[model samples]
Target: MTYSSGSLINQKKWILLFHFIIGAIIGVLLLHPLTTMVFWYEYKGLIEFPGNSPIEFLIQRLITEFKFELMPMSFVFALLGGIVGLLFGLYHIRLSGQKNLVRSLEHELAEELPLLIARGESEHLEFKSTYRWDVRQQRTNRALESIVIKTIAGFLNREGGTLLIGVEDNGNIIGIDSDFQTLKHKNRDGFERALMDTVKTSLGGNACALLHCRFHDIENKTICRVIVESAVEPVYYHEDSVARLMVRTGNSTRELDAREAHAYLSSRTTKSFSL
Candidate 1:
């Protein structure tokens, strides 16, 4: 989302040049004729022409005197048009930046999830069997939600990462049907809402903006992929009255105590995260 100074300057120069060219064309083709008509109407009785009809006379004079009389007026109109073009160009650049950000996100999702999963868990990747369902006990475990939130906070506090739910630690696709059954709506929509609610309540609303969730079907089973972006400021996991800073050290989420949290924050520079 950040651009180098040189890149920004280059973009500005190109935008200005493009707009200037367009403005000059409009000035010569449109503004010059409009101005000529206004002047002709104002001095219609005072001026005499060789042609019988007014329209014929105007056209004849335009063809004959264009270079000599209209050059200065065209320059003035072109300058005014250039100023208008610059304003529009600046607004266009701002709008294009936002559009590019959206396209970047779309490109990220368009990438093959299976290929990413094949990489297995790493510093930037983690996998969970379910959101709240306990495969071992064959029941919904509310405690598992806290673990998911903790993992998200860890990624936010660190360099950011992707968390795949409905996948085993070893990368097997189990699907989240078990977790969905526990929800009232029992679908991807319901599941995403629950996940976001948990994140907002435990990790804060701002953290929810840093996470992107999507569902994909792999081998007749649906899996949820949560992409986390590093937070600009430190993020902590809130559990009742306690707040703990969790970080991803390697493949696992680790909690940092007061001194450790301070040291981590001091050593780290803020990063920009966009949805």
Candidate 2:
């Protein structure tokens, strides 16, 4: 639902009003005894003693100086009234604020998802640092590789996902360490080729057709992107044309589950039947 600007303004006003009322009530209650103490001490010659006897003396002084006859039931009722009113007001304000927060988040997500899906944001799609494909840390840090594979695979296995090689999950454009020349020097056709080959070997053709590898440049630095379309068949990576499987989950590539294998086959069979 949409909240008009006027409604939002009124909501803020109500919030402030509630806070003001609670503060006023608390201020009066806390200050009333102090005001009464001064009146009793100054006007009625009532005094409180020092140290351990201070509280006792104050109670005595208050009883003697304050003569307004109030019933225990009335005082109890009044105190309860103030406390309940204050609590209810505070709760309402907090509830309103939470509602606003949730609404704002929903609105933000609606805007962000479109951009993310379109790869519309330059900061998200383009490269930032010089390392396009360094490969210096470890030849095959299978752990890190797993995360990339998982994200890509999850994206592909669901609807589709664009894996930007050089960026973090938060859309910070950190370029991969290796570029085209770097890949060629390292005897790899491209990052996509290596990733695809790996996925194919691991998943055994389940991940192949849906995979698209490409590069984009921002500030003369190249960043790789692997786009995985929804799987019509199970894609697996093979080593030396022998089936050895890997499927990405988050940043880790693991052997496929029976469920995943079945899902791939089911999707392929359904598509073939439709065709």
Q: TM-score per candidate, in order? A: 0.60, 0.37
Query: In candidate 2, how many Å is residue 226 off?
Result: 1.5
Per-residue CA lDDT of model 1 for 1-275, tens digit only, reads: 77899998998889988988787777666666577677677777888655666577657655754486667766787877777777788888889889988877766664678898889999999999999999999998999999999999999988899999999988899999999999998999999999999999998999999999988888888899999999988898999879999999989998998899888877774323222
Query: What is the per-residue lDDT of model 2 for residues 98-159, given as tens digits with 9 covering 90 to 100?
Result: 99887686557434533563454231132122223335563434445544555555555445
Q: Residue 45 of model 1: what lDDT?
A: 86
**Model 1 spans > 4 angstroms off:** 1-111, 269-275
**What are the clash counts of all predictions, listed in order?**
0, 43
Top TM-score model: 1
TM-score of 1: 0.60
Off by over 4 Å in 2: 1-140, 178-188, 234-275
C-alpha positional error of residue 163 in candidate 1 after TM-score superposition, expressed in Å: 0.5
| lDDT values for all models | 0.86, 0.54
User: lDDT of model 1 at residue 17?
Assistant: 85
